[model samples]
Target: MNKKGWWLMLLIAICGIQTVRAQGETPTDAKATPETLSLYKNLLKLQHEGMMFGHQDDLAYGIGWVYEEGRSDVKDACGDYPAVYGWELGHLELGDAYSLDSVHFDKIQGWIKTVYERGGVNTISWHLRNPLTGETSWDTSSKEVVRSILPGGEKHALFLTYLDRLADFLNQLKAEDGSFIPVLFRPFHEHTGSWFWWGKDLCTVDEYKALWRFIVDYLQKEKSIHHVLYTYSTDRFETEAEYFERYPGDDVVDILAFDLYDRGAGYSEALKYCASVVTAEAKKRSKIAAVSETGGPIAQNTEWWTKTVLPSLRPYDLSYVLVWRNPWQPASHGAFAPYKNSPDSEDFVRFYNDRKTLFQKEVSKLKLYE
Candidate 1:
């Protein structure tokens, strides 16, 4: 929809989500497994606080620690970490694979456990490659991957095997006490964007919904993997309808979120609109909401941390706002988060110190996971 249409819808969404006798703040029992009850409670508690921050590869690895494991972007900058940690399951579904930078598929499991042990939250996304042709995720050269991954198709069995490997990896995320580590696992993300193989143009609504439900079922019910909170996310969606266009169902989704970025000069408009939609939807459904991904060249925009970024989030009760990784040698132009001695370092320190934003020390002290 156009920008004007989106704003009009946002007004209605705000009314429905924040008022008009919607369900209470408590989620209406999303059928959580015993393993995930406490985790869901923690998410609800966080929603009330609306104070959590996350960084991708914060503890597992970063640009300077390409060869080393157990490092963090936040730690390098300010001797602390974020409350939530974001990781990717790319290339790991198929063993012996390499990342986009050709790094071997290793260390992610250890990192998940590390974050869990530290009483931090773990959220994972998958840039899964095409199961049909073994091409990259954005290689939309063919439209058969989603179809074939469904039941009774050419690659269906292979997809199951891939999932089997994925389940194995997830099952291995454990604390030192042998308890399963809970994670917010988001799959087939950015469906609103057409760059990925699973984009809106490539599949019918039924096809996409089926694929999401099937994966959730196989992993949770069939694989007996209950330590996961399945999340539904999109990128830069404007309206409520656009947000739910490809949503599988509430039964299969635990968290409702969206990713926004400073793609151009000012993204504050889109960020506020998307956050309103996401927050309203999550509240209407009694689920948690988060800014799954967002960042910009903080180093270039010295005031980005407090001025442009945090101000846009002053509206609602969001669980977390996770920025992209801080690249030591960015193939792109800029760093998503500030690093030590970076141009935006002082602003970032102030942003972290602000009581509104929760860092690892604040969240860890809560022992939300325990």
Candidate 2:
């Protein structure tokens, strides 16, 4: 049988009998039962095993990069996303390029707060820079710094400085109800890969674990910060074992997410890898799983995504999938050189619509806390 036939048969096998209710069962059914909602909440607390979530490093740059100037363009760019996902987690690259001054901090805090006020979730992460900024001199003890994006070494001392400031900022932003929902805090993500300064070269598994434990303890105990769900994410690595090995552990991790891109590569293999590594790990941990980032070169085919890629991932118990917009890329292909848009965006639109409908259908069977 062909792909469509195979999908249909699988659908029937899973939900055909399950969909029917006994006599006198009426329509207008709530998505899920309360018990199941509780179960989902408990399961989702694992963080790493939820749905695919969206990503916006582009927005981060646009906002944080020339933050000294009033970043209208940056604000405008991020404004585009609230219509689709209702939430976005921005990656703030805190290198020599941007200072952690009031201008930078206030701009980011304002942007995130603005989105949050508009009924969207906004969060941020920063990449730790290599060679430690401005110092091989490393502050041996926790000292107040405008921002701390240190690359490994004496991490406990360096990170405590950063976390102290972060916790202070977060506390200031708490809502009237004193709760911050969906604070997607991630540090040391994508460590399995070689690009980052602190990648495989920077530390051993034991060191990674110790660092994670220290951060979590400092954040929760000293700061009274309970609202954040820390994510353990990695770039799709050479093998699943490599991916699994970097996991910091359940005590320190609240979410499991992965970054994958087609990058002129085949979508089929990408999706298969996602299933094998991300999806399988999520199920094992009973954590939320997300496709944190994805998009392709502009010259690529969109049909594969719309018809094949999008449709292929829906059957999995996924939480969210976010498309990356690199300003360098558009929503669809055009004459611009090195354009970024999936080749088959139209198909993606159609596929997204259909999958959303299916999502609603499945969601209806879910139980809620109410």
Candidate 3:
């Protein structure tokens, strides 16, 4: 409250910034490419200030912000948006695209550019369908799918065509001022655990690494899609060795991140343990870290916003923590950002107001884009 106290706080902040800058490994603020230099550097600076809060489908939809249909829960509740917006490239990979989401491609591109120009961060995850079986990402029945999409396989060309489609889509993300919209493009996430076709048991370590390298190289080198920062993420890991077991090497990855969906594995304790692993590894690698995806039943636990979630992140200065989307169905309990009059709405307001948590309101003044 006093001038002396403010000076001390300022000194501590400067020292924090200097300590992280001095302990450099590669001086990457989490950039997958040179195009993301501004974003990378700003995230590094933010590591000294406060952690960012992200929301999956916050723009496309929320409890109120439905795709092509409704309003925004975040805007209505907190009078601002999320610092980071999470989206999916799944339907776009499928060609027709509209089969899954009411949100159209044109709309998505517009929103992405808006967020980028507004100084908000955008992180995209892919749930690409099984190229071999024409099935969804969750269908792992075909053991041969991973091999089919690799460089030497039969479906390899088809997969490249898919990449071309994705490239075309990403290239459209330009701000009104004509600058490319830099995005945190996360692909093949949660590979450390075996759930998807690209997971641990489905592909060998070398095969996974090769896949990642090829994807990043193809998109950048061949397609000229340079408005992206590649993020390498995995499911929860217990040890440092386990975390990097399938890493695609430091050359390709920008942000070292992971997903931790606490489905009854001791809740906050499990989250804290995994958070330590991600943040430490990011610092060691000189990359920014994030809780790429996480959420549980917040409706039942009212104080979840301020108590459980924020406390789990107190030990780490992560770039952002993106909770899962808030589906519009009446029976859903998985909404991460609270809607107006929802059970956790008031608690979420407290989370938004917390000095340690960075939201869109706070980000408006941070000048992250510059």
Candidate 4:
């Protein structure tokens, strides 16, 4: 009885492990909560249906509005909230009451819980100030910036303090039922460009990779934050090699994403090419793929959404495509999405009605965290 029983148990255990591996059910966070695991699987499944639409700072403020409850430019124009909601954590590292964009941390927290309870997705990106110079994230004044914040670097301790603040915010994103609200935590995004301190030219590839790994390790392991999924994103890239050049590794990245704004006539081709490459790579790795950030002023082309954005992304198996914000200041370049009665509003509505795009009404039916 002892010999046969033990051998059968061992064989069954091995088979179960193999089954999970074959199905690609393991998240990058080994200890990811059950709801987090469910969310990941649902995102992977949603890729086949359509890409979810996302808007940055959608509920915090919008064109001609500030902190108005239940207000969103996207909703005003299209009559639906975006399926994915994007938030920024730039000033949280400095213990600021408001984000760099001036949205209060408490408001952001409440909005995140609202989105989660409604079964929508939440993704947050950090634009923390450069640790070396205490300047904006765009301050690439020092090449040693990335190195300075790494494990043994001079500012490593300070970086941990920053991470601690971020962890505190994330750990508090809880629902009324006491379960953590899972979110896509995208840190150090757009690293392919030189504008940011951690950009490609600012840090060696190995250093960049190390930086990414250290963040994931510290947040998930040391800080005990298991409700987050790490996203690896680049600003723009022409080839798969460029996209993965500084990738942290499969074990630490749950999503493969990129951000591309309209740059001119080449935008469409570039979008199609990058989407194809990213989705294909994601398929190969069993990871989620997305256009994490995109959209530019559409004044020059009223049909931009339907003709350019939709067409280029319609063919890819991407989880979501997010446009930037519609700031209250009319002239700010931050207005990437159309506002109510804007020239491109009609086109945006068309883009939303398309079968290939998923907005709040559609995504709410997916039960992503169940």
Among all candidates shown, the one with the greatest TM-score: 4
Worst 10 residues of 4 by lDDT: 13-22
**How big is the RMSD of model 3?**
3.6
Which runs in model 4 stand beyond 4 Å of their true positions?
Answer: 1-22
lDDT of 3 at 252: 82
Count of clashes, each model: 1, 36, 3, 0
Alpha-carbon TM-score of each model against the true structure: 0.88, 0.63, 0.90, 0.93
Model 3 quality (TM-score): 0.90
Q: Summing lDDT over every window of 10 consecutive residues in candidate 2, give the lowest-scoring window.
A: 83-92
Per-residue lDDT value at 360 in model 1: 75
Candidate 1, 205-318: lDDT as tens digits: 888999999998888778888788888999887678898989998878889999888977559888888888888878778788999998886766898989987888877789
Candidates 1 and 4 compared by lDDT, better number:
4
- For residues 23-104, what per-residue lDDT tens digits would candidate 2 score against the true structure? 3221111232332233235324312222323434323333123333322221242222321122222212232223332125
Which regions of candidate 3 deviate over 4 angstroms? 1-35, 64-70, 330-333
Q: lDDT per residue, candidate 3, 1-370, as tens digits?
A: 6433443474456444442434353322233344367577778667656778888777777663466533567766776688899877787877865525456777777778778777899998888888998888877887777788889998999899889889998888877766678899899999988889888888889889988998988887788876687788888888888889999888788788889875765878878888888788787777888889988777788888888888888778798888887877664356777777889888888887776677775676666655
Q: Evaluate all candidate structures by whole-model CA lDDT and list the values in order.
A: 0.77, 0.46, 0.77, 0.88
Error (Å) of candidate 4 at residue 257 is 0.4
Please give the ranking of all candidate structures by lDDT, highest first, separated by commas.
4, 3, 1, 2
Residue 197's lDDT in candidate 2: 47
Order the numbered candidates by TM-score, best leading. 4, 3, 1, 2
Candidate 3 steric clashes: 3
Per-residue accuracy of model 4 over 40-150 as CA lDDT, tens digit each:
987886686678999999998887889888888998998999999999999999999999988999999999999998889999999999999999998988999999999
